[model samples]
Target: GGLVHYVTWPGSSRLLVSDPAALKHILLTNQRNFPRPRQQMSLLRKVVGANSLLATEGDTHRAARQRLNPHFRFANVSLVFPIFVETAHRLVDRWSKLIDADAAGGGAAIIDVHPELSHFTLDVIGLSGFGYDFDALASAGNPVTDAVNSLLTPLSLFVLLRSAIPALNALPLASLRKEKEARATVRGTVAKIVRKRMEQASEPVEK
Candidate 1:
C-alpha cells in the first residue's frame, strides 16, 4: 500500500494508484492481470465503437494499436502538422473578432476559453483524423459538432442512477433517448467518412 489506497463509493470501492513504477507495472508490464471495468468500457464503447482500441482489451487492443502506430509515426504525424498551425490561426482570429466586438461595445471581453479550446481540438481531430472539416471554430451549429457536444454533456442524476443500477438504462427517459440519438449520429457520421475513404481507395489511379 506504499502508493495505493482504497477509496469507497456508495456501492463499490477501488484502488487509488499513484506510484509511477506500480502504474507502469499495472498498465504495461503485466497489463493482463488488470482489465478495464465493465462500466467504463461500456461508456467508452457507446461513443468510440466496440472495436476501437479504447474499448477493447488484450490481443484486440494490441492489434488495434499496431494498426494505428504507423499513422502516429514521426513522418506521418508531420504530414498533418500544417493542419495544427492552420487551426491555431483560426482560433486566434476567432478570439480577435470577439475582442474587437467587445471593444466596439465599450467593455472588456471576458472569454471562456474552455469551449473555444474544445472547438479547436475538434477541428484538429476532424481534419487530421478523418479528412473532414468540423469548422467548429467558425460556427457552433455544425451537426457533427452538435453530436459531439451532446456526447460531452455533463452527467445528470438520472445518468448516475442508471450507471449504479444498470436496469434503469433500459427505461424510456428523455435523456436516455437523446443520448441514444447522439450515439447514432456519431456512429453514422464516422461510418460515412470511413466508407468514403474505402471507396476512394478502390478507385483506379491515373497512370
Candidate 2:
C-alpha cells in the first residue's frame, strides 16, 4: 500500500512506508544492506525496554520472528474464535439493555459511551490475548481499570518524545523516572501473566 507523506516540523523526518516492494528491495534483493535505524530503536526501547523485534535487527530479529511465529498460526487463532464471539455478544447485550432503559425513561436518559467503549476494548484484550475475561464491561467501579486510564496521557507524550529524541533512549538503562515506572508497571504485569501461563502449562491437566 502507498503511504501519503505527513507534513510536519522542519527538522522531523517524514514517515517511512516500508511497502511490500520497498521491503523486498531492502530485505531479499539487498539482504546485507539493511540495518535497524537508530531512530526506530530509541522509540522501541521505552515500552519494551530491551532488544525486541522492534529494537533488534539482522539474524537476531529473523530468529526471534521465527520463534514467535508459531503463537499466531491460523489453527491456534481458530481455537480462540469462540471466546472472542462471546465477548462481542456480551457487549451487544449490554448496549441493548441501555437502549431499553432509555426507552423506559422516554428517551431522556443520557448514556455514556466513552467509558463503556474503553472497557469493552480492554476486556477484549484480556479475553483474546490472555484467555481471561476481565469483566470490566459488566459494571462500574472495576478496580484494575483506573491503572490503565491513568497511563493514557503520559504514554502518548512518551511515544512522541521517543520518536523525537531517538538518542536519549541509547543512554544505557536510564530514562525519565515517571516514564520508567509506567513502563515497569506494564511490563511487570505482562511478566506475571507469562509466568502464570508457563506454570499452568507445566502442570498436569486435571481430568
Indicate which candidate wins on TM-score: 1
**Candidate 2's residue-wise lDDT over 1-207, tens digit each?**
555567655566655665888778877677668766665566566555567776777788789889989978999888778876877798889888888998998895466777667777878777777866668778576445554444434345656665777665555553455555666676777678778888988999889
Query: What lDDT, from 0 to 1, does candidate 2 have?
Result: 0.69
Model 2 segments more than 4 A misplaced: 11-40, 93-122, 136-178, 205-207
TM-score of each: 0.84, 0.61
Candidate 1: residue 7 lDDT (0-100): 59
- Model 1 scores a TM of 0.84
Worst 10 residues of 1 by lDDT: 2-11
Structure candidate 1, residue pairs in collision? none
CA shift of 36, model 1, Å: 2.6
What would the per-residue lDDT of candidate 1 be over residues 1-207, giving only the tens digit for each residue?
546556555556677787888899998889999998776777778778888887999999888889999989999999889999999999999999999999999999998897778889989988998898878889857877777888876666666666668899888888788888888987898889899989998999999
Model 1 residue runs over 4 Å out of place are 1-23, 106-108
Q: RMSD of candidate 2 to the true fold? A: 5.6
